[model samples]
Target chain A: MAIPLIQFINVSKNFGESHVLKGLNLSIYKGEITAVIGKSGTGKSVLLKHIIGLVQQDSGQILIEGQPLSQLSPKKIKLFYQKLSYMFQDNALFDFMNIYDNIALPLVENSRFPKDQVNKKVLKRMDQLGLIDIEKKFPSQLSGGMRKRVALARALVMDPEIVLFDEPTTGLDPIRKKKVHSMIQEYQKKFEFTAVIVSHDIPEIFNVVQRIALLDDGIIKFEGTKKDILDSQSKILNDFIAGKDI
Target chain B: MLNKLIEKFGEKTINLLKSFGRIILFCFSGVTNIFTLPFQFAKIIEHMWFIGTKSIFVIILTGLFTGMVLGLQGYYSLVKVGSEAALGAAVSLTLISELGPVFTAIMVTARAGSSMAAEIGVMRISEQIDALKTMHINPVRFLFSPRIIAAAISFPLLTALFDVVGIFGGFISGSMMLGINKHVYMDTVIQSVKIHDINVGFYKAFAFALVTTTICCYRGYYTHLYSGFGARGVSLSTTNAVVHSCIAIFIFDYIITFFWV
Candidate 1:
């Protein structure tokens, strides 16, 4: 059996009177695409946030490679964070910075690479993503799909081991949504990076995601491969996959 | 009814105090980040150009007119007392001790401070700040520290420019327009203005810089917490930044004057 790369053990979170995550336990394996599907406001995004250390869990522990995150020393924690990347729902590209600068920001802020080297790395990544002749254009100048690509380029520029995507295809047409899913699948294969996506695309998402975790009422109600989910006896889980509200 | 009234008032008071405490902590974070390694020198320079260099024309225009008005008014009042020859002393003293720093700060608050709030509020609402955090960068250090440092450097320079241009403006009204001796006007300004007055102006400029930039940036950085979400949030933050900074400048100016005097 493969050891999980990241694990959430009986974690919980509450925002005032509303409890978001309750005694949730999950594990993310290395180099696979896992999609967290849930109804709106069911703490799907919160789960992703906890994985990236944006929002800390109120209780329980998150372990990375069998070592608890809270127990890691400051130096180890810094190294741990360097191995993760996030793609926000809105892309969150710096509107003030052009394409070149936006993609190069992580390298510039985190590394001692020289100007030419940064340029070479950024240019190569942009070229591979087919982002040509738009280095000077700001994020606002790009179309929604193009902006998504730019954001993915920025996320991959650091060569992180895990990438968390929060609703990568919200507010897109069906074709664009399919394109985004394919893009994620293609990149996940090419880079061999672990992916955890929060999505609501229903059956469209099942095609790309190898594993599905159905969250309900502050806990993950189901977790398994697509075949296992289809073969399960839980009616609510089947309804959820059919785009029905539980 | 009486118990409910008291409870309401108490709640409001506690909330206000909590807000004040948070503002203080936010300011401390921004100032402390300046000493942190890999200081944002380039960003600071860019902001200085935006806040200081871009503001030269407006500062000059206001300063010149203010000096001219002081000369004219001082002439009328001093003429009544038969001491109109002291016009140079009067004009330079008013500008150097008080008007230059206060007016320059107000102008900058209106122009740069408001924009700072709006821009940061947008970034907060849009979660660009969070993106910075995910990249292992401190958002406050990246976004707020540069503006703070730039404002600190720019305010005193702008105040000095205001004083110099103001004195020259007084020359136009007192010596050139009103036909007072040019040498006498220039001589009185040079002779009567003490180093103490200049020092007070610079100190006030520095203090105002801290008060205005801190308030503006704090309001913007915590826009989500303060003003709900979206365009309304950004709008409210900008309004609060401008209003609070103006009020703070006046209050701080009075405090500084009380101590100096």
Candidate 2:
């Protein structure tokens, strides 16, 4: 088998008496979409954060392309983060910034791009995401779906090596969710970067993802292709697929 | 019972020491990042606008009224002692050496200090700080250094402005109202004032600015480390920041002034 693009080795995290992640191990390959589907509060988002160094695990380790993230120097870590991007669940857009500046931030902050080029890049991404002429509007002025799209635009504007989406389609309507799923597919096809999406939106996300990892009790209880998950005899996987809690 | 009291006292002392250590460390990190790679000129300018320009009007009003009051009281007392001509010395000395920096700092603590806390507190609660971190931007450099630098720079200037405006206020009340000649009053002020007094006021102002901003920023920046009340947490941080800034201002003022005395 090929070397895994990202690896979690027996990682554990605890908040006081409660353990959020308990010796979880998983591997993600390059150029693939892997959706971590689990019930709310199962440490799915925590695992995604560890990948990008947002949150640290209490034990074990996380490796990105065979380089241990915990061991990287500050300079190297920042340089590493330039190649990785995360789209927050809150859209985390600066409230004071307009949509254009919001989308333009990751580029402008990380690089010394000229004003006109920055504008062009931001406008291009906005157009690709169907966010035309709304540059002057603040995040507060935009609807939830529009805000998420603007946030995603900021994430992709960097053209990173790995893109992590946290609950990408959580609050959107069915049509908006469908539109977002299509956008992800379209962009993933164009960019071909590794994608790890943390979501509880199960069957809805299943069709859009190539692989599925079922997280339960702070561990990856099941990991395989959608067909394998569907054909498996695991009670938890079956309950998850049938929209019932186990 | 006495042992319990002693034990409780020891625990409280350790906790207080830890908090002080934390603030010093936070200040160290913030100051170091401010001088580190790629300083932000634009954000610094914006912060100066917020901390300096927006604060001038209220400082002017307070300075003028305070000077006038000092002038009125001083003129009355001097007239009783048949030393009404000494009114200029009293007003200028008090305004420059003591009240000017102290009042200006208190006003700013109420105005800009609390707002800085609220702004950073909101950013912390909302995860904008995390967003900056993920984008490889240091939150201390990007969010903090500018405001701290702005307050330090603006406080001394505002204290000087307060001194000037207050002298004019005293001039009006002492000369125009109490019938002391403008020329004699001006001469008295020029003669009585020394450069050391003004310098001391500014040094104190600079020190107070650093203290107030550091306390407010540290308190607000670490709101998440406080109890998790979500919106309530940010609000509490803001309130505590303002309160702490005031307390730190007085404590540092005494410490700095004690050295002078």
Candidate 2 residue pairs in backbone clash: none
Candidate 1: regions farther than 4 A off? A1-3, A171-179, B1-10
Fnat of candidate 2: 0.72
Cα displacement (Å) at residue B80, model 1? 1.7
lDDT of 1 by residue, A1-246 (tens): 688889999999998899999999888889989999889899998999898888999999999989999999989988888889998888999998999999999888876788889999899889877799999999999898788878878888887889998988887779878877897898889989999999989888999988999999999899989998878998889888776778
Q: What's candidate 2's DockQ score?
A: 0.74
Candidate 1's docking class is: medium
TM-score of chain A of 2: 0.95
What DockQ would you assign to candidate 1?
Answer: 0.76
TM-score of chain B of each: 0.97, 0.94
State each model's CA lDDT, in order. 0.91, 0.87
User: Which stretches of model 2 miss by more than 4 angstroms?
Assistant: A72-76, B1-11, B227-229
Candidate 2 local Cα displacement, residue B208, angstroms: 1.9
Between which residue pairs do clashes occur in model 1?
none
Question: After best superposition, candidate 1 residue B91: deviation in angstroms?
Answer: 1.4
